[model samples]
Target: MKAKIFNSEIPFYELLNNDLSGGEIFTVKSEGLKMTEIEMGDYPEYSEFVDTDAFRDILRAEREKLRYGDSKTVRISSFNINKSKGVLEVGFHPSSYSVYKAFNAIKHYPPQIFYRDAGHGLYEEGTSDWLDTGITGNLIRANHCGTGLFIDCAGPGGVRVIVGMRPNREIIDTHRLFRTYSASGSIDLDDLTPFEGVLREAREEINFEADASQIELVSFGYDSQLGYFQFSFYHRSELSFEEIVTGAKGAKDANEYTSLDPVAFSAENIDRTVRDIAEAPWEPSALWTLVVLVARLILSDGAKKGEKSGVTAARIDDFRNKLEKEIKNRNYESNFKIFN
Candidate 1:
């Protein structure tokens, strides 16, 4: 399948490309939506297996912590985007995905992709025969997913930059540069809407608190490699680049990353800027988020404060055109197809 993609090397598969015509937004909370309950015994097939015991033994704080806080997560059974109504309906269930399941899902798929230099050039793909939907693993719920946000700062004198992070060496995707914030669907963060969950995480990650007014939904994608679903967003920050960095020390997740990585953004050379960012050792999911957002920012002409981001079919077509060329220019294009 020539899956819709930003690049073949990247596992991100663009599923629903909703460009809201009027900078509109949608929300998915624990209430007022379609949800179900799925137990572990539902699918017993073990085409791919993960040794929970061995994963626990790894000397990683993040991995070990999840075991204790076994919280419920949102399992995305299905989803739909009604452009006309500006509605995003997410069909999910209460599921639990601890480190055991996350490890099983991203072992080779993300480890090697993000840490290109460290990877041994070998890994596996897909959790089970779950290519049709999301991957549900044996020991964990790999189908349980999260959201990623690409936040940019509007610094002094219109000095705008894309914010990224160099993760701490002990985390899951150790020391790789990634998006500004990540809202994993857990007991407290399980919301499909861009504003609720992502804003919550951003506050914790960088001591920056933002509401729906400054964010926009870029796209929704499924990572075939790990059987993961990712919601992407483009967020604008009013704080200067320097102020944003200093505030991180005050945040609860201050130790989460070693430092921040910001890429200068200008519409004149955005294609080149994104290509350059792609060259860094990056978490594939974050890179995937960057791939879709740069185009939107360029067309939007710098995100405005106190305003919601909107998308239209015509705008999407333009962004897709630029993205296709960006991927093809690198000769990194392969199976995944987006914008089609």
Candidate 2:
């Protein structure tokens, strides 16, 4: 529901004593003689006053601000639309200049406004590194908590990464894609098995067999919606066109969870697609997965370096013992939430 305040309205303050006791001045409609629902809240006394029409002018100007212009329009796919501040916010592609131009033309509300680039053409690439100087929500908190990404092995040339698509019966064949795919109200960092989960999802969804070593950690990101989070991981091993065709043979009638079309993706197309989808994942948790995949590829290719391996399980019992001793010596527990 929308409440409108018109021009040439007089400002009045009111005090209402009721279940909630708080009051403020309201602008009276010049011709309509109306006020906002908020203005009508529990006020016992109303005081009318005449002052400069600054607030009214500002309101009118804001209302008159146009949404789109003649400039190029770029679509930004976002994991969580709720991530943007205000009741609503407009977002654009990361590489899009028009988005910046449009947003800069209009002053934005503060403390909750930000832009995140998922990547170009509906793939995950650069969302995790996005810095949001706004209040943290559940998705953000989950990303901060501990999620990871995974990339399927493409070829020596690398795989085309796409943002995790929304949960559609057509997209992921839940039964066949993963060895064990399950859902929960919450996931424990200790008990979370994204690697196992994703492998299962890939097998069921795409009918691909992926070895554990074939998966690599990319980066960490979060989804503001669903509050579900994950890590991004990627792989570059590829199959021949024949292999792809053969693997997808019986996908249709098997489970009715997904439909496989053995399509080929070019490097340029894949890059753009991954980047575009990064802005929005069909599932917000998939955003983190996309980010991690992109990050690993970039790092392995000598593009960026010095990334942190924030989560881990000890390889050797001796190392584990030593590390635990050191941690215990310093009396250090993880500063972040680690539910398992």
Candidate 3:
């Protein structure tokens, strides 16, 4: 499909050409949103837990303790940008086995370097126009930080299942989360397709299948180094806890030096079990989802005490049908572009 895009500074129109047959040009509505505006203030405080020296020392300790006894090497890739009044920075740290091992404890995506052209070394949070600069894996370089997500299944009325991977070691501890081992490989870590990657990981790790219908794109976020990313989360059909755990245990490959580990997700113990992989180390999507899930649990619990006051089942079904038709109409319009 072909359309025109114009910037305020440029008086003339610019042609926007695309082969996609059916999609709306919603860019106009999203133009004003900046990448660095996300608030990073609410992250867990680990001030007493780690200092730069202590962190580096831990890395050294883990390397010394490797089963195969290999020395760890660090790799780094980075970039800088000029914002309105400040410089925005984004990028990645070293690409080494030790960095991979550190992912479990950090719980954040890999860290990329962020720096401004002319300012103090540390960029204050929330002062820049963009909240996060992280992008999809497609855009990541070896030393660039790309966006990714951590999605664990929660089913059977809010019971949570943790997803984890272990590479080259029996287990590693970060953020105190007890993660199970899983097969590890150097796959593209783009944010846009991390959902698909997760599904692929699920299949390889535990022989579990994720139907497209069962998956949902519930969260969206970015990192300072990566570009736009979608944190897609999914929940499979009902399965016994033993089945889930068994699936995890069986998800090891013959050639790889990793294994899959799945544990039940419980908020009370999650902080103790789930580690951060990123440098900034926060899962806003997962965190917000937990809040929503918890709220839903409360409402559902209260509903059991009394008659459900929302729409009747029949009415809800009718509304769903109506909504489907509307969506189809919109899709038809969007699909029109591919033909043109």
Candidate 4:
């Protein structure tokens, strides 16, 4: 199989130039839906997190127990984009590990950097199954999963997206963790699929009560460098802006979110907010997932038929251009080199 590439602007396509064959390319689709999985070869150059003394000590203590091949954790790194149904599905299987082991073995590197770098390279070159044989071992490649919801409310003041400010005590504190977010946690070992996991998280994190039918899966993909899968969900709430605020506030104590912020999804505001998010400390998957949803929404019919179509179109374009630039700059700074 030849290398394949898919992104916000491009449609899913298989067989890249017909130059390679027989290699396992995990791009699967069914029933007018598309999914792609890219294997990120060992990324040994990223030392932002591994270089810490604390990380080293943790690694030293837990290295023996966290050996590769000790347990095969299978995760669903799946992204389903259904244009006909107007939904994107990103889902991941949950797994569990000791908190102490995770703290020491896991790196706090920005996930977006790894995803952007690894996804770009994998898209250009076919998948490879090389594991890093460095001091960090293959621990960085452990399969982790999480769910994020992009809540959109369309009312008198146009469309707004709900965002949550993470509390300081949490692992990713202060940074926004999507509207409502949660990791797979101990529930990964259960029979729950990625879709069910997100639904559970939505209820626990934001008191969001919607049948699975009401929510649509947009797109889902895996980031190999980060050794994790991110499942993103799109939910359009019937609640009024005030109701959403009140409901979200009530659930604040149930989750790690410090406060709820509903951001106007105007083009200008999106452009500014995305730029700010790139600069601020943020959950990488949440930020990128939001970017993907914004790109999809701006092109949807709802956005086009809105009262502010002209302004929305112009602002969406601007936001897209700026976001592309941001991704490019960050990729460059990440110094991600693809090794064959």
Candidate 5:
């Protein structure tokens, strides 16, 4: 798969390979991108935060309340290959940490001890972490799978992207950053396979029912920064933007999203959207997912037709050139290797 970023068309797998090769040390420096750096000493309450003996006791009690035999585990795996040679370069599993642990680690303690407790095998045996530590191992360790949906709608104006607003504040705040229309939590121990999990999330989070026929698998890969296998899907909506908004409004109470926002995907407006996405407090995966989606859209058939129109093509090329320069100046390094 190829993605058009900023105007440059790049192979999708190459981006993933570069990202994974960078390991946990890679960072994106751009305006509007919000990255949280945890410094334990900066917070005066740091000492009291880690002392969760009381919380641990509560978690222990909570475990007793769960159904018996709830501590099941799942093995997660992903492999990268050279498309040209059809040679498998690497095959690996996600990091060893549980989903709950990774979430709490990023969100911090005290305010989100619920996740930490869940991570300690109180809720499940092995949940996958959202962030990858970039450590490689041969063992098939327990991990989770996450799904992201990219909903697209075409109208008189142009294609519009629909994303969900996460309602929960105590955990990962969804208000600031926009997420896929629906996304699944850690899939470890779940009966549903990773693809099933994606469809399930669409129904639960957006009240949008989708089946295997309606959803198309756009990309499936590992994000080394966020240590989980991510499956991205594309669903074309027959409903108009107004109808979508109406449906979402009616189902707001039943879903995790408080509301839905449809952003127009056009060369004229992409810069603003990119800035908005960067400024918002978004999930790391959501950010990268949008980047990939935008790239794909730019290379779509519709975009190709627009290129003949002159105006749209010029706008897109300008954007791509700008992005290419930015990436070039950054000197981003990767360590990906191919094995013969």
Candidate 6:
């Protein structure tokens, strides 16, 4: 339930690995992404926020009224994409969702006793590093798994991407409802790689278990508002749109979304769909996932990218490029803000 705080779009994302290694490199080895344990108690800043009288009161109040899941989260420590090896690697440590929330409140909320560098200080002081600004700014920077679950199916016209409509915010434990891309959630403590987390999230949210070969890396981005690195992916499914929705009724996290929408895999539809989500209440990671997924559809050869190309392969770079083209072609503005 990491909702957007204000009216502005948080920040634009940076690409880690632009495209796949030669072919669309989906690695068989899980070792590419590694994780080590962390002791959150050892971080003094964490203790400060958790121990704060006002913050504790706020947490207690929120807990009494709304639903909050304080599960163990994964934080990226080091990230690298080994193009030559046809794999992407990430090193991360364990964290809790509650810790992430505390960090968020410290940065965005006002009048908290242990408020570090709160509002203006965060923007003005830090360049690339958040440590230059707030008390637990570094901790805030590396938090949660903003994983997207895209369930793709073949349609009469062509491939159609399934989008989800979440009714009550309680489903995601968020502030507002959304028509976000299929599904998006965090990773568990047991997860080793981002793909694994995506799969798990998909299974829970939509009751769809995907094959390893069918899964493709759509894009890697950072959500500065939530302050965590997000990895978005899509799983090509043999199921029809109806079958997929039917299966979703039996999902473990079926309440996460009330219904799913299938959109034609086209540029105009992508633009329209994003505008709908953006104009309403939606999360940053989900919006970016849809942007990148549509970028794969319009900018690249095909949905799955390994076919020898007279058709140029799509790079992760295409996400921003697509947005830029949308902005200019549509006579919009500076960034990929909420609307055009």
The whole-model lDDT of each prediction reads 0.51, 0.28, 0.32, 0.43, 0.43, 0.55
Candidate 3: residue 19 Cα off by (Å): 36
Candidate 3: stretches off by over 4 Å: 1-124, 132-192, 222-232, 253-285, 299-340
TM-score of each: 0.62, 0.31, 0.36, 0.53, 0.53, 0.69
User: For residues 254-330, could you state the per-residue lDDT of candidate 2 as single tens digits?
Assistant: 34333222122232243343334322212323322332233333333322333333211111122223322432344
Please, what are the lDDT tens digits per residue for candidate 3 over residues 43-145?
1122222234645565576666566554322222222333242332333222345534443323333334322221211222331222223221222111212
Q: Which candidate is the best by lDDT?
A: 6
User: Candidate 4 lDDT, tens digit per residue, 301-328?
Assistant: 3355663556544544566567656655
Residue 85 lDDT in model 6?
A: 68
With candidate 1 superimposed using the best TM-score fit, by how many Å does residue 168's alpha carbon deviate from the native? 0.9
Error of 6 at 260 (Å): 0.3
In model 5, how large is the Cα lDDT of residue 306?
48
Runs of candidate 6 with Cα error greater than 4 angstroms are 1-10, 17-31, 38-69, 108-112, 115-142, 156-159, 165-167, 267-282, 302-340
- Give the Cα error of residue 297 in candidate 4, in Å: 2.1
- Model 6 residue 243 distance off true place after TM-score fit, in angstroms: 1.3
Candidate 5 residue lDDT tens string, 8-103: 433222224223111111211121112122232333232233335754454354445443323332334334333344233223222222322333
| Higher-scoring candidate on TM-score, 1 or 6 | 6
Q: Residue 322 of candidate 5: its Cα lDDT?
A: 56
- RMSD (Cα, Å) of model 6: 6.5
Candidate 6 lDDT, 1-340, residue by residue in tens? 1112122233534343233323343332344444445455556564465566876775665445435546777765555555566566555667667655554555656544444454323222342344222133234243456677667785555556555556446556544344565766777777666677778887888888775456766656566645666776777678888787888897888876667777555544555544443344345566555554554554454445454443333343343444434434553333334431
